[model samples]
Target: MTFFSCRPDTERRKVFHLLSFLFLAGFLLIQSFAAHAALVRIKDIADFEGVRTNQLIGYGLVVGLHGTGDKLTNVLFTRETLISMLNRLGVNIRDREIQLQTHDVAAVMVTADLPPFSHGGGRIDVTVSATGDATDLTGGTLLVTPLMAADGEIYAVAQGSLATNAFSARGAAASIVHNIPTNGHIANGAVVEREVPVDLANRKQMHLSLRNPDFTTAGRIAQAINGSLGSNIARVMDPRTIALDLTLRDSIPALSRIGDLMVEPDTLAKVIVDDASGTIVIGNDVRISTVAIAQGNLTIQVTETPMVSQPGPMSNGTTTVVPRTSINVNNGNNAKLGILRNGPALSDLVSGLNAMGVGPRDMISILQAIKADGALQADLEVR
Candidate 1:
């Protein structure tokens, strides 16, 4: 009778345990939704493979400089090019008779980008940089020059008035310069003479290249594409590329749809340091193992005091100059040991760093040391 009577209590305990599990699962699901990463468009992280910028280069000359042009004596090509240009304009000149000074002219290289879908007779901005010993490019105008592509085919003709962001002034022995005067940019400077041909509508497949390559990100991207459309539409070819098969779907419509889909990209945990600028960039997902960091600043100061030793009160002695210096060092007492626990979130990591009260440059060194000791769980890159 007792054994049969105990069945209700045992069943009640089992039912309570099941209820607890369900409640815990529900809480976890809610937390997962709350902690979701920010959504970004796939177009922001990747681009279509065939859609890219083309580089066009041209050998050109800049005229209308104020005697700051290339010296025609040593830069012989400048004179030769000038003679050829004059001959084209119906003016005859021999090599020996090429003595127009040409000090107001400079040989420069003109460069511009022919963006995808650029057509004939369209204008694009151009950058001109002096190739010779010319000092400044300000107040100069670029001459007509044929811009060529990698295939040695003429793509555009560039000619325009230069607008320089830098300037210079000289007064006999003193001169002040701001920015680089040898290089300048002219907006909408070149006219497109030809077209670079590529058929985008007839492609059976297209590839998406990530700006920042990561395997996890690539997989996530493919999954996002498939989840929005269907299975087998997007496939990962590698860590940096995702191939899209458009044979089954409508080409233009499908591409337009892909751009609208939001995908959460995975970024590698990294710390980038720019020593020249004293800048440090810490990734949001950066982590650290359990470690103790003790850092401090050491400053040394030196002062020079020159003294003159003269003969004192008619005592016969030669006057002399003596150099005196003082040196001092200060080791800051602000240095302290801080223990960091494993698997810190972004806030915790930032809190720990802020507690150290160090500058960006000092933080860069500390991060490098932590990475070397196998404590920092992120890629340390120095620029």
Candidate 2:
């Protein structure tokens, strides 16, 4: 009879636990909703495999300079190239003593990025760097030069007025240095001479790559995609990849229509710390699992005092010197470890640490130690 009478109490306890769990879950749901409201497009997460820029570089001459060119002795290529060009121009000067002051010129290397899907005749910007000992390339212009890619193929032609923000002036035993002319830029200076083939619509399916791969994030991405385009349109390939099945879609337009759909990504909690830069970055999702943190500074000081004696006021003894030393060590007694029980969120951790007057750098080290002690649940990455 007693066993049967205890049923009501057991039933009441079970109901109370269920209600408490539901209340906590509902609170967490609301917090998660408010946290990630800025939705990013799926296209921003992935890079198309072959769609990239090709670095093109070429050696060229920057002409029309004003008394700022290479020192003939250090740069042999400049003199040799000038002689060859002059010879090609039918100026026959023998003896290789071609020591003409090409001060109105500077040797430069031109560089440009050949963007993927670049077509012939497309214009691009180019960077020109002085390879010679030119003081400045300011107010100068670059001669027409062909830029070549790694394959030795001429990809673009660069020519424009050089704009250098630096200059230099020199005199005997003294020199006035200004902006760095060793590097300059030309806006819209090169015309693309080659095309890179990229076909986005040719394939029946596509893959979305994540910038930072996380399994939880990938699942969320898949859910977001399927929520917008309906189920079976997107599937998770891995933590870093998602396959989109465009074959079963209505048409190309339908697939393209979903590309603009925005979805909020779920990222893992992490705190990135750079010790060399004294920087600390905390993510909103980071949480602390109930830990105590204390901070203190230990300082050691050493001082030296030197005393010189002059033979007791000219008693004719060689001056003797004596040294006095003092050393002190201080261990601060101000900070004490404080207990933080059942720590739930990142702000609580930050507040607790900041309340102790811990700087960002010190906080990073303390957090790392807490992580090592198994008190911090989030990842602490030191870069």
Candidate 3:
């Protein structure tokens, strides 16, 4: 993400000063981390094709609130819905002008993701977000609501007491805010009414994809699959994708064995920088080519004084005012450009940058410059 541009020679002085500040900043960042590192697993970084969850959503109403629900005026649907429910319960209320306790309820949209192959009667967590102008939903219970998918088909039924991380209290003149009001969640609120059709159990072959694309790792995975099953069933199509040949019955076990197989994968080191937040993140594999760096800064100070003098007790002297000004300029110590030779390790590069007395903001820019000049071997991403 970090893009670099050539700095004109005329602006070199200013740019170099800034670069020095950045070098120091980058150095401090590297010093904060421990030297040792943990190796990541190939399965941890990648996903397989057709193995994902589907989103399900439905418009629903949350009832049984403690007098802190959507207003009847803003949520006309709530009033209409309540009326319909009462009629079903053997109560006759034809007039819509009935004074309702809107302060104790809210209307919300419920959503949840259906994992692949989710069966009927299985429960899933649901998220509820108020769709009306309701102020709060504390101690509210969600009524029976049908969760639907984008296809307009009912997939699940959600009903449970909402768990809100936020609460609110209001007075005649003022109010207090604690947490988010518009949204809450209910765990295991939705029971799956339908199932997503997937062939995982009956499929002849299956594929395991890596979260991160790496040709080396993909090949290793194929090897593991073939070795585990004693047959060449798994093959790598690309760094991000793998194809498992299910032509034979034996291929089934080959695919299943892949889950437990271990494959060491190679990864490229990178450095990520966020200019807006002045953040710099360096990966373990980041390497820098040898280069010399020098840094310095200039400081300017200004002061002003205004003085007034009045005529003394006797002589008719006119009053006068005088202004005095003073200015000073201070240049920071000019550090010599230190040489960081090629084959420099991540630690050495950091140490050298720190020695130049750079700041975080400055280091961000310097890293960008170094990466652009091909002196840094790591990928530089800036946000």
Candidate 4:
């Protein structure tokens, strides 16, 4: 016990340092693995670039209305369209005759979305809305109209009975209406006439676009895909796109498998507020720092009463009016100070604030104050 060990102390300190370094490395490795545990399908996060929807538009006529169509005197296009339609039907009708009897038809614009790989003779729903000032389109049937793409190429033909959410009943003096009477929908009313060519099999690669862009999500998606396929098949090109090589005979099967694979995605904390409707939305990962806030209400009142003075039975004095007013102010003097000493999750923060009986609009103000003071750790958007 009388001797001091010199070399033992040095060696012991070195061993302790090595052990700490190993412990830190192990902890960080575990954390990295844990972050990737939550899995979401690739299909939910992105869409195939070439596999998308195309827009088609057409101008048509809705007929068979009970005198609720556009007036031919004001809407010249309706008269012109009616005459053209009649001429096509071999009736040889003139414009002057149409001007008097064309009140049963309305000019409408048809719109529809054509999905990818849509073949000829496929059926699609179409929306019909009056281009003229027509009162209603209920109980109307759309005429055969050619739908065209942006390139002036006809791709579909639409014709069917219209279904509308709106109804209007009018008498001589009063009328009641619901929903929109000028618009209607025709289910499976448009038949595809031409197909847009897409070669998914011959493509060298497949591109997926994210509905919501995030760098972390893109990386995680790539990692999960590469992990599932047992090769580096997928890679993140950017925050919003993921690319995969399709150089195999079974490209479709591979794509389906990739869609089935899942990966955890990272998200940013966000809070949204609508001042008009007093709506407040908070993300789950939202965190609040330590802070002190106080809230109270202030009230002010003002009332007025008029006093009348009548002339006496014999006196001829005119009646006089006097005004009496009262004013009061009350500011709540007992708002207790609220202390937030720690950052908490969104749920806990909401519960704590709700206990204080704070409303959504008031919460908006409080959040703004907290943000200005640098205690709120999320993006706040007011609409």
RMSD values, in order shown: 9.2, 10.7, 16.8, 10.9
Worst 10 residues of 3 by lDDT: 33-42
**lDDT tens readout by residue for model 3, 1-383:** 12334445547878898999999988877764433233334456556556689899987778877767788776898777777877888886865457775577787888899998799999999999988887777678888889888888999999999888987878999998898866889999999999878655456656667777888878887787687665677778888887777666554354445565666666778898999989888876777877776656678899998789888898989999988889898786655676766644667667777777788988997888888788888889888
- TM-score for each model: 0.84, 0.74, 0.72, 0.81
Looking at model 4, the pairs that clash are none
TM-score order of candidates, top first: 1, 4, 2, 3
Residue 81's C-alpha lDDT in candidate 2? Answer: 74
- As for lDDT, the candidate ahead, 1 or 4, is 1
What ranges in model 4 sit over 4 Å off?
1-38, 93-98, 170-175, 301-328, 332-336
Candidate with top lDDT is: 1
Per-residue lDDT of model 4, residues 1-383, tens digit only = 32466777888999999999999999999997787667678888789878888999999999999888999889989878888888889878683443365677899999999989999999999999999878899899999999999999999999999999899889999999999999999999999999988887667688888888899898888888788775667878989999887664367777788888877777889889898998988888889888887888797999998899899999989999988889988796777778765557777888777866778877889999988998889999989
Candidate order by lDDT, highest to lowest? 1, 4, 2, 3
lDDT of 4: 0.86
Candidate 2 is scored at a TM of 0.74
